[model samples]
Target: MASSCTKLCLQCRSLLCSKTVASTWKYATRAHHCAAGTRIPVHFLNGFSVLNEDQKTTQTRLRWKQQMLYYSNLSAIHQTTEVKENKDSEELSKANVVVYQNPLLPVDAVPVTESQMSLDLDAAAELSALEEISDEEAVGISVPFALPPASTSLRDYVDQSETLSKLVQLGVNLWKLEQRPNVGSMLLRLNFNTDVAPRLLFLKEVGVENSRFGYIITHNPFILTESLENLQARVDYLKSKKFSSETVASMVSRAPYLLNFSVKRLDNRLGFYQQQLQLSATNTRDVVARLPRLLCGSLEPVKENLKVCEIELGFKQNEIQHIVLAVPKVLTANKRKLTQIFDFIHNTMKVPHHLIVKFPQVLNAKFLRIRERHLFLEYLGRAQYDPTLPSYISPERLVSLPDETFCVQLALATLDDFYLFQKTL
Candidate 1:
């Protein structure tokens, strides 16, 4: 009986040990699965029924500790992952950054030192100071007020009574000033005593009459802006071109814009007329002195007229030169009118080109007048232009004589008869 009891007791002890070990094994497996973020099997929890009350309490406490440890480990892992992601994002941002470099600087250029930089600044300051001093010296005195901006209107300065008074004293009336607001605006900026008076004095010295100052300035206010030296140089150039002092003065008075032309321009114009017309220097000077405005306009008309006189009118080069010497304005005459006059004289009047050259003034007469007179003379059987023939009329007398004089003297008829004859045409 005793031997049988011992074997049974050992079997019972072995069964209890196996149950405890199985329960512990299941509990450990569940904790491991929970920690690994996997699902805990429901069968693993059933093993806890085999345990005693004390063992169950201890097993419950162990499970609770394991769950807490598992959650703590999960939080640590999640924080580590977030830190890694942030580090990667920072690296990507660093890769995307761009750096800029100036292309103008030389690759080997040295950075400027402080001393050199300070010296450059000082030199710039000195240059600006010197410029200011030079400006004061150029004006010959300190300016009382700031000069008006370039865009300021002349009307704005019109309210300034002193400026208007000075302009009035110079004979530039309000009407004249209004005629050229641009000139008046520029004049408003000038110092009257230093800038304006000197130009007036210079004009006087150049033989521009004092009485004509108002006319000259009104016609060409820009003359006041020209430098004295330049005005003198232009006068000298005219004198050098064989124009007398009085002739130069008279030319300036007649054509205020003539001096506005550069010396080279005047020379070219004189040379062109002289070379084209084949005139002597003295004759060229005489022509320009008589017609100063000839120097002002384009030479193209003059050129076209020369070609017409030579090619169309059949005037020899020498004959053209003679005509131009007699009538300097003929060079600038309308090309079509000139052609018509030549056509009438040559084709209708049977007048020779040489005779036309002898009286180039005939070219200056109105075409209708020339035609009427020639037709009248032709009616009278007195239009014989041959110098060798009897009762031959010079071309000059044909056109130059007044209507009454032409009828009685050249046409050899009464004025009433001439008028009657004109009505028939």
Candidate 2:
């Protein structure tokens, strides 16, 4: 058996050594490189193993062909993958543009090309010549008349004037005089051309303080141009209302526009407060002194607010007066806010009616502040919702204290907790 096996191996070796098989072996070996990157696996090489030498030789050939086919398929796959990646990259490079077709053109219209540029040159030249002639006829060739010389002299004159200097110092831009050339003449007439010193003395006589007159004039330069008779009448009206000279000066300083108000306008505003609102002379003066602009506003709205507070919201005449005296701003509150506040105080908080009159300033408190303080106190068991149960903390104490003092003394909650509670709400 061993001799037969040896003989069979010799015969197989001889057959494998023939020219055709030898050529195929040499071609396969040369074409298929075995390197670290492309080494054949041991399992793959063993897959062709056989006990018979002839079978082994045939299997080795089949394995080589299988490996070659696998490598060919792998190369084909890699090339296809590269081609797909390049195509994808090209697609990515293209921008996503929204193209709208021209409504006048056909949807499938072919793009114009350079060959379509051929045109009749002589006809184009004649058309251009005709257009030029039409344009020439339509447009007259008159030269622009010389512009009026820039007002160098007026600017130079203003730059030299002491009065103009004073105005410029008070934030008045003289460059604006370009728009109102008459203002230049007005300034010149008031400061230099007219008797300004006597008029200034007259203003002093009218209770305009010497120190404050400059500010008044600076604010309303027209005051200098106003007739002395008209000025005196306005001043006389204020004096007739029992406003002292000091008060008049202070009012003028606070609102220079008051001087510009006519006697009839002034009387109307004063009468509204004194007659319609029935504010006493003292209260009227206090309201005006506190907020001079109050008189400048329309009386009808203020009257309506006062009426709502007194007649509809059940605030007494004297209580309204107290609110005005304490916080004159409260009288200016809108009707809805006035009603809401009254309701919140009288119905919601269960505060006594007379108590509000006693502390009208509580009405002046912001509704949010009043609500926060009251609710916090109720939470702390320091305030009773029932009006009959005397409050542990007075409404005055609740609203009046600053945040830190209120937290430490009244709410007894940490500042963080109080602020956090506010944010949550």
Candidate 3:
């Protein structure tokens, strides 16, 4: 039994030695190919020829452990290199991204260091520890102009001189200054005695009231920038065209931008109106003074309305002049609206253009209101508008009177009836 057991042990040891040699030989061949030109130890190649069988097995086990450790460390180093590469790529992509910033918002201050923050805290503490001084003990520091309190409006800040103060008293407020900052800044740089006062005095000399100075300036700030010589020239041109000083003042006050027109431009506008309306110089001055805005914008609207009156509405030249003289607004009224009103009056109401000239206010009333009232009157059989008739209802009163007044006075109907009629329409 002992001999058989010894034989079994020897056979198992021989089998283990054969497997270890085979694995070692395979590993060494692979390592030689992978390392290319690396030298192998003589004992490793010779398969531990000098060592005994037990020693050879022990050395084989140690070599296998060392190779396994080397492979694990190599895998760990490869994974670490890939992770570092990925981290660097992510940082580069983040650097390429763009961030947007709004121009209107205030920029953030630089980050405060710990030492700087500590110093700031110390400074604040020292400041708080300082004693407060009385107003009498405070030193008076004179500046070019006294800055107003922060609580006051921007106008207060702008009113640094007596001239600016006078403007504030008149009517220029913070809103007006902000709306035209360029003009406000220009005024600030101007000398009151040399630049602004002369213009104020000129406006006054032209007969503009002191109270109107604010209104004029607020409406047309460019008036301040106009040279006194140019302003005088404009005023002189108006006077030369037979405009009285009071008429010129009224025109300027009503349309503060009037003096901004050059002498040639003013003459051209006056001549155009005179020629178009067949007005004498006196009548032209009166018409222009009544409606100064006529010379303000483009004359294309005026020309179109004139064509509408003559060609479309079939008004003669003289009748057109009478209509304009009565209501100067007729010249600037929307062409289509003017035609609609004239069509309803001439064809629907059987009123003549001659009658419209006398009561031009009919053209200014809303078209729907005119239609409702006229239809109501026609329904009652009291729509007689002829002056020769006994129950003559003037075209002016038809539009000018309120609903209640028209119902009671002109229509001879109750307010309820008129309101009911309007709703039905």
TM-scores for candidates 1 onward, in order: 0.57, 0.49, 0.61
lDDT of candidates 1 onward, in order: 0.72, 0.62, 0.74
lDDT of 2 by residue, 46-147 (tens): 112111223235545555454455434433433444445545644422311101111222222223333232322333455453445556755864655442
Global Cα lDDT for candidate 1:
0.72
Error of 2 at 235 (Å): 2.3
* Tens digits of per-residue lDDT for model 1, 1-425: 99999999999768655423543454445445543343222233422312123423554545445454443343343344444554566653332221102222222222445554565566566545445466666678655754456543455565464655666666765565665557666667677777778988888898889888877877887887888888888889999887888999999988888888889999999998888777888898999999998998888888888888888788888888888889988888988888888889888988887788878898988999999999998888888899988999888888888999888889778999988988898
Residue 236 lDDT, candidate 2, scale 0-100: 86
Where does candidate 2 clash, by residue pair? Answer: none
Worst 10 residues of 3 by lDDT: 98-107
Superposition error at 148 for model 2 (Å) = 13
**Model 3 Cα shift for residue 372 (angstroms):** 3.6
Q: Kindly give the stretch of ten consecutive residues in candidate 2 with the minimal lDDT sum.
A: 95-104
| Greater-lDDT candidate between 2 and 3 | 3
What is candidate 3's lDDT per residue for 6-71, written digit by digit as tens? 999999768655433453455445444433322222234433212123424554545444444443
